[model samples]
Target: MTISDYASLLADAGDYSGRDDVAHLFPRFLALAELKLNRVMRVADMEKTATVPLAEGEGSLPAAFLEARQVLGADGRALRALPLQEFNSNGTSAGAPIGYAIVGAAIRVRPKGGENIRLTYYAKIPPLTAEAPSNWLIEKAPDVYLYALVEEIAIWERDAAKAGAAEALKRQAMAGLGLADERLRWGNAEIVIGGLTP
Candidate 1:
């Protein structure tokens, strides 16, 4: 569904709950729902790869980055994730980096040098807005957005019963989305147990 559809549904919800007085806050509810979704949902659709150029072993993370999955060197070697303290104490030897650490919004690679790094990470969901209208989450699972918005609105209106019901539905929708993502990612893969295939 597009942002308009979501807004319309939210309006209907507000009217149904006898809370139309808070209609001006529908956009805020949607924004809050998106924030909650970003914190809770991690699926294949959110995975992104970015090439970051380092200057003196430090580079800014992608704007959409949520969490890094892997960091690779220019030579395609995976860099080990190191603790910030350990990475700092590794000394400043100019060359290729073997480890990296996330420091705030930047990545610090040990063995200070200038090179390009590939970062694979979970990205923030493209929020639904007038400019963007919709995203994968909306297209694939509108119920998730619906229930999440409902929950937020219910909370704002101080309706415990509505909030509780919406929260339960939201959880179910989120779980279903996760399950669908898992099936798409690994349903055909073979399972291995110890040294044997299962």
Candidate 2:
């Protein structure tokens, strides 16, 4: 999945509608959970460039996955991201039709309050032809490419929600005295925990 694949839909985004705790970003997280890993395999089987002509078309999954392999070293695990760039369909180069084997995009998390978290995703795409995945193509156009992009954005929003909730929890905990430490202190009313002795 591209960075936008998750960042756009992440619940706690720069412009999240539900800015509450993770509770508000539930829709975002659900979107992440909704994205299926199997989509990659689906992308791989897409029609080949040889068959559909450059005019045919894409898989964000394949492109992103391949990029992941290169960046993450093909360990086959999803990488945690700190978004900086979101994938955007540059759109075909006029009269180019769909000139990609598979298209991949990003859902970037732009640092608003000062965080550069990014997530990038990749996918494979086959050419647009009868051989291309039947479910994604209709008539002669590759509408499936658009669907893939939208799906990626939704996933990004979900991840954002998770990040926001976690950040809030951390803030709340750090701002208050922990109960465990107090209990351990017990009778040691003025114990020196880590101070240097003069």
Supply every candidate's count of residue pairs whose N, Cα or C atoms clash at under 3 angstroms: 0, 56
Whole-model lDDT, model 1: 0.85
Worst 10 residues of 2 by lDDT: 50-59
lDDT of 1 by residue, 83-184 (tens): 878888875666689999988899989888789999999999887775666788877887788788889988987899999999999999999999999999
How do the predictions measure up, each by TM-score?
Answer: 0.88, 0.16
Candidate 2 residues 1-198, lDDT tens each?
Answer: 221222332322323333434444444443342243224332222333211111112212323243432112122233233322231242322321211122335222111111121223333432322233233222222222323323334445566655455445433432232343345456467756697867
**C-alpha lDDT of residue 59 in model 2:** 18
For model 1, the stretches where C-alpha displacement exceeds 4 angstroms are 1-22, 193-198
Candidate 2 stretches with Cα past 4 Å from truth are 1-141, 159-198
Give the alpha-carbon lDDT of every model. 0.85, 0.31
Q: CA lDDT of 189 in candidate 2?
A: 78
Best by TM-score: 1
